[model samples]
Target: MSSESTVLIFGGCGFVGFHLVRHFVKTSTFTSVAVVSRSAANHDNHVDGATYHSGDLTDHDSIEQLLLKIKPTIIIHAASPSPVTGTPNEYEHVTIQGTKNLLKIAKRSKDVRALIYISSSALAKGPEHVNLDENHPLANTDPKSSAYARTKALADLMVLEANNPFPFSEPSVKETSWEGHLLTASLRFPIVYGTHDPTTIPGCLSALQKGQIAFQLGSGKNLWDFCSIENVCAAHSLLVQALLNPKRSPGAAKVDGEAFNIHDGSPHLFWEFARTVWKFAGHRPKNDKVTSLPAWFVLALASFLEWGYWIVTLRTKRPYNLGRQQVEYACFTHTYSIAKAKERLEFTPKQDFEGGLKEAVTWSLKQDHWDEKLKHVTLTN
Candidate 1:
């Protein structure tokens, strides 16, 4: 980054966003770093050395003013509703319209030379996704998909399209800082987990504490990619470096107006992830056994349970533990190729899988003050 380089992150207090804040703060590469969060005062997980601001993404007036005041050289948008618990309206405001506002304002915030979006590769297009890459068509408007997925798919496309400095007028041949175009890119991830993680690792450990580890959702052959937090953060840093050195040729073109899948370059059986978490939690296999349940049968059982629960509990915010989406994730192969990330951003996993898991489990349990005995953990809402 140049002497005027300043990085501003939209969701700086979030799981992924905070990790990025820590990454930049620890590395101290940029001249200044700032983060905008919806609620800045409530973050117990916030990192040091980075300034924090409270602001809503939908409020265009405040966001535009903040951009002008900060004059950031690099901007990373990692803000969005929770994928598991978010509603359709939440997706609309934050993922879709919020992204539109960011792009619209970014066009005028000329100091912003680079924009990186943290996106998810967990789009449910079919029963399985094997080695899918940036070329895979997005199902942003699929009526069958969840609102979170639909809107996220749409926002990622928006980020790529906004790469041009002139969206309304004629396009320029090449978009660079000289041309005043925002060099935009998106990094797609699946199942990110590590230290200070509130979801992935904890969910697995919660299942273990509830004595549900041996229950298989479907055939245990399904596979999914998992990336450590350090790996994901490393990819973001590499992209920042690449975007700053865009004149590096063939590799440089890969940074702008592109989306890249990022992961550990290895895929494991779905339940294998949970089993590994249990191993780190001072547990030994009593037996190599699991109770298998057919996926179709589970889905049928879930549909009936969902209707009855709605009638009984009337829980409008439905988060059925055994819903169709959960079943598919546990029974399908959802793996992606990180070849583009490697070739374009020169990205690779900074932490080894099992080693990283050990570090995560150790840090997470310490936070809970567990005394070598597994304690009860709430797995869901």
Candidate 2:
């Protein structure tokens, strides 16, 4: 990479995006840093080291202009429908359409170097298995599913195939004529939890506050690889910086099209993780009885609530909101192996499950967000 290399990150306002933006901006390696989001959020303005551009991923014109203006060498497309937000179609629009827009932009950006997509491990083939790697097929036939998973799977395919160095079909629209191949890396992340976690933390807290969480979801033995937001950001940065290194990178001849399971390398059961939060928050499990809700019932309830809201509001909004998905997902076991990333990207998670949860709980207390009664819980032990 040249000293003139510019890096542009899409969707830098959301949780994982915020963490990535902070990491890239502070690195001081790039000539300039730019962030493009649907709108300029409060946190966007506060990113001292980067320039923030207001642009929506679904808007082709905005994306074109943003690409033209920034002329980035490294593009990090982290913008998409968050796992907890948007209906099924909305997920398609953001993940698929947003990616198409970015790819179009990348085709135009003559100086572009690498494009790294932060995808989800929720796209894994084995929602029932313990530990999965990149080779596992996606759970394409899961009857009980969320739109988020489906769209991510689609987008991931688009990305991998888009790499010209690979033997995939070329997109009809090439915004700009390309000189060489565009390196694409798909980093699949697991149940990411950390500071600025607008969705996960709040939903969990709401259930606890309402006394709705009685027993662990399922048998509570299903393992999940819960990653820290900071660690996720760190690994991404390492990958980006490595792309600038000629000896390390796959070079122009290589597609650099690879998928790596990104996690903290440790799997924790749903009950085990929940118990940690309860202890830290100074609360006892609301319901001691472990009752099992069949997967069919959970999905049915979720669909009913989702459709009911759509009917009532005349909008495709989920009725139970983000909480419904959390309840359902908590029952399943999901884990991934990050060994590839650790070896290739020189990545190591800085925060483990225990430390990350503790920090998150502390931040919640500072915000006065948690139930006041549980504030005195012995967190240190």
Candidate 3:
């Protein structure tokens, strides 16, 4: 990586991609930072130094035209249809086929040197598991898995499989192994949240504000891992650096062709996360005390709703909220090991968890001048 190196991010306007564009631009590492997204023309929060291009990943001509035009030295892909949308067709075409198209064109490009794909830990086996890692076989292929899981797992494997072979020996000395080689790697993230988070944090706060979160869904004991968006951004930057100088990286093998599981490392009780949002936002459940719903009962009812919805809609649309997956997630424990990331890329959460929560809440409050009402309140508890 040098001053002349150029980087392009797919879905650069997205929650993850735009932050990445901001990250690369702030570092000033790449002279040219370009963002390619389907909705580029409508995005207004454009970073000053970076350029935005309208492109579709699922279209070969779209991908071909962009790659030929940009000729990026480092390509970071953070694009995927959001899980909340639950649009299986978009998941199939954009995440699965779209990644296929990007790789086919990128691998043949003489100027491209590195490719990093953002993948999801949802592909990990669901329920009754702890510290799931890259070796977990991407066990999301279970019969109940959604189209999202299947597409992500398939695309995740494809990106890693495209890596160039590198000497796996540790380096007592540093070396440049990136020239003329289009190395690829993947980062699997779990439940990312932070300031400006359009999905998770805002959704929870909105539901809380509306007094929709009436009761606990499960035992409220399951430990869920969350990665701050800043930490995720930092991890991508470090992995990009590690891939550039892997031999010098304090690890046994080059980061090429490997996937890393990353999170904030401290898994909190599942309900505690939502409670923190309420706590910081100076709100509480409509009820004075939260009560638990029977996990098995909820799961069964969700199954019935999912089946009924699918039948009524002829499977064109999924449930807006209640589903088997949602119930199961509420009931089960989900955590992943970041040991590989720590060892290989020296990646650590840069944003402290407590502070990140406060920042997220404060930002949300500032949106409505809600902060002025509770300046004395803080996260002392």
Candidate 4:
């Protein structure tokens, strides 16, 4: 806890919260940044010393009046939803009632100190065959898990039981606080590419500019792990300065309610990261002659189109809004373990996952749907 620090950012105009409000507005250790966002052009109003506050994280009195008017000292929950307009009850209404209304407004923001949270390496574990970590094992009954991994494993156990100390006098807890409050952390990430990737490569380049690709499912040798949106915002600013300086990690109280796995600990495969985005997008496309399939026949055709969108939303009464976790994340395969964020958050992922997929395929081949049969399917896949 040094000089300037007043962070607050819940989904700060998204895409990794707009690269964490442009790295906390070019940090000098953020002196006030507020954000909240539900609209107001989705916030990121060019962050310098930030301040946006619109609303809607399950509207608990608009996040308790912006957490009692920006009483922040860091509280970044990067707001969820949008696995295509979410469901599974909108992932239990914004990732578990918007993280219990942002931990009931960070237990009444008593100068909030640290909260972080940003979860999703599909709720701590999954792509096994070895290489997990951060005490992996929260699959929460993985019957091909998703409703965003059981609401991110019930919102990482409500931020580790809201960092105990008799969480509201513990007998079946109920949100009490003070007595050293906000110092919760949980950054499970992965598949978090760069430069504003609104969920997985700009939604796979907006489903290849609305063509809505049909085939090409799995056997693109699964493998996952990826990071860099400035190395996951410099490993969340060195795990919030090793949780506000605990001698910079003398095993910070045996890893305070831990959950690590950020990524880039190398593993690429998905069609060799789609043939280095078709040779760094110098002209390949049409999913470069797409033709792979077999991860149990793409999870048995996405479990028969998730039972044909659950019997066409129970015979078209309503509710369809797509997502079904992209056919169980196109036949899963996450692969993490950044060795406890490179041994207690010293963290080090500089990007070069095939050089950031050739700079997100040379900026998606300079946009306008790079055609020519996608450059002859990128010169023949």
Candidate 5:
């Protein structure tokens, strides 16, 4: 709230966390900003004003010591393994147990005021979640969901349930007279894309370079939600402001122990968005360049590939990317409602779909993978 407040971001060296560090350093009034990562030695994109601490969330003693040393007023939990590539053990250790450790430490830490978690829309289950909201049932109960999703859902529940005004009955510290409770909340982001995105946009560029972007999954009629990196950073700032502001009314009540979906506020057809990005990246799509296939056929192929990869990697630990989840993401129509985020956190998307795509494409053009043959192509018209 004030310049005295210290904000600490876990997983600060990561894609989203890097943007968050820059946002806090450039925009936030908080005096002290620190990022915790497993190893901060060679972090390439370090911000000027923020501090980086080498720590591991799985190491409970290290985290406890770091929290005691820094005494941060706000803790932003953004550290987690990649949803597509991480193993079950990594998810359990870093996402579930690590979050539990943080909750345990924050409950007794007097200076800590708020704990903001970065969650995913994958927590919602079933095809019926076309317009998912906070009340949607979590996928943690579903056995068929990915290990990452289930563990993250469990962590989300822990953070929300730990949001008590009174400290836990069994305090971590007995002699301390400080008795402040921690406020907690979470923001669910959908397919975040921006300059430094290591996932969606890069994967698209790879497909385009390999000439594999010609086929559309199903009819490409599915509308999906995407969150711009800038918008995600803005939502975090707005929620933190609401959580720390005492003068703010009961409207802020919706934020405590609550989860809000943040997106670009515009859902776009899957193929249309893909073609737009391709066009912006200097690849012009022709009528024959793009084709559609039945969703069932593609899903079947994905299942086969998954089975083959699992059998081949019986002894190794390699991960397969093309699977049922990828098929579902390509063909499913799941858009989140950002009305709660807007009303509660006063959050509005700063960049629309085209603008965000333009930024991402501009960045992509400068990368080494940009095709020289279509260098003159533009998103205009």
Candidate 6:
């Protein structure tokens, strides 16, 4: 609300976190920004006016010290274990326990006014459905859900349940003098892709380069949802603004202890979108070069791979690139409705599919692994 309000972003050096930090520093009215990261190595990427604090989320004392020193008015929790890592223990430690620690510290802080959590749509249970919304049940009890999903669902519950208003019946030991409540909300993001993305874009490009993406798993017509990095950052900005100015926000009642799904508001056939990226990246999906496979066949293969990897890595933890969940994502339609976000947070995608794809391709081209020979490659269609 006030220009003097300080915002603290956890995982500030990460892909989404860095963009969020930049968004607040350069675009939003918030003048004071501090980023808490596991390492300050990316401090150079932070904007001129932003401050960086190095701290580990897993360490209670470390996070507490940082919170006490910064005394931030707003806190954005974006740090979590990488989805690609597929380490269950790591997800539990960083996502569940780390959030618990932050909540404990935040509850004690008199200055903290709002807390925004960055979550995932993987918490959706059952088969992929169209227009899934906030009322959809979380997949915490789903046996088939990924380790990341289960852990995140738990963390999401904890965050929403921790939202306590002022004049609380039970107050924290350090917050006796505080007058206001700790406002909290969560944003569940779908496949987020954009420049500096460490997951989606790079993984797809690497598979394409290696010729591993030689086939479409299903009809290539399954609709999927994606949220651009810019949109993700924009949603965070809107959430922060709403928390700061509740009466002015149109959907103020929906701001507290709420979770909203964020996407580009456009759904596309899975492989069609992939083909667009491939074409833009100087590659053509030829009929001969790329084969089409039945979804059942791919699912069978994925199951075999999952079992084989489990046996092979019995004593160790290794990320399996192909699994049942990956196959389900590729074969099913899973588009979420962002009506709540649009109404409540005034969230909108700043870039369309084509624009975001072009930006991603342009960014990818500048990477060191980009082949010069592929520069002039053109689409056959």
lDDT of 3 by residue, 248-315 (tens): 43345558889999899889888777778877887643445667899989988988998899889877
TM-score-better candidate, 1 vs 4: 1
lDDT for each residue of candidate 1 in 1-381, tens digit (9 for 90 to 100): 556578999998888888999999899888788999988878876887888888888999999999988888889999988876565677899999999998888877767877999998875365578989888877664676656667888999999988853332333322434335787899899988888777777777767777787689889998889888888888988888877763445423457888989888888888888888888887677578788999889877766765575567554454646655566678878999988888777776664888888888888778855423375443222
* Clashes within 3 Å, all models in order: 0, 1, 0, 2, 0, 0
lDDT winner between candidates 2 and 4: 2
Q: What are the runs in model 3 whose C-alpha is more than 4 Å off?
A: 166-181, 246-252, 284-288, 368-381
- Listing every candidate in turn, what is its Cα RMSD in Å to the true structure after a full C-alpha superposition? 4.1, 5.0, 4.4, 19.0, 3.9, 3.6
Which residues of candidate 6, in runs, are more than 4 Å off?
A: 42-45, 167-180, 246-252, 285-290, 372-381
TM-score of 6: 0.89
Q: Each candidate's TM vs. the true structure?
A: 0.89, 0.85, 0.89, 0.32, 0.90, 0.89
User: Which one wins on lDDT?
Assistant: 5
Off by over 4 Å in 2: 41-45, 139-144, 165-180, 248-255, 284-300, 307-315, 321-328, 371-381
C-alpha local distance difference test of each model: 0.79, 0.71, 0.78, 0.65, 0.80, 0.79
lDDT of 3: 0.78
Give one digit per residue, the lDDT tens place, for model 5 in 1-381: 545778999999898999999999998658889999986768775889999999988888989899998888889999999877776778888999999988888878877878999999888876435888888888788887767778888999999998865343544322233335778999998788888777777777666666677678887889888888989888998898887765554433567888999998988886666677787786654455567889889888987887677678762332445766777788889798988988878787875788888788777667534556344434222
Least lDDT summed over 10 consecutive residues: which range in candidate 6?
167-176
In angstroms, the error of model 6 at 175 is 13
lDDT of 6 by residue, 208-319 (tens): 6666667778777789888888889888878887777624433345688899999988888877666667777777545645677899998899888777776788823544
- List model 2 lDDT by residue over 238-319, tens digit each: 7776655545423333326778778787777776766676556666544356666666676567667776767887766665
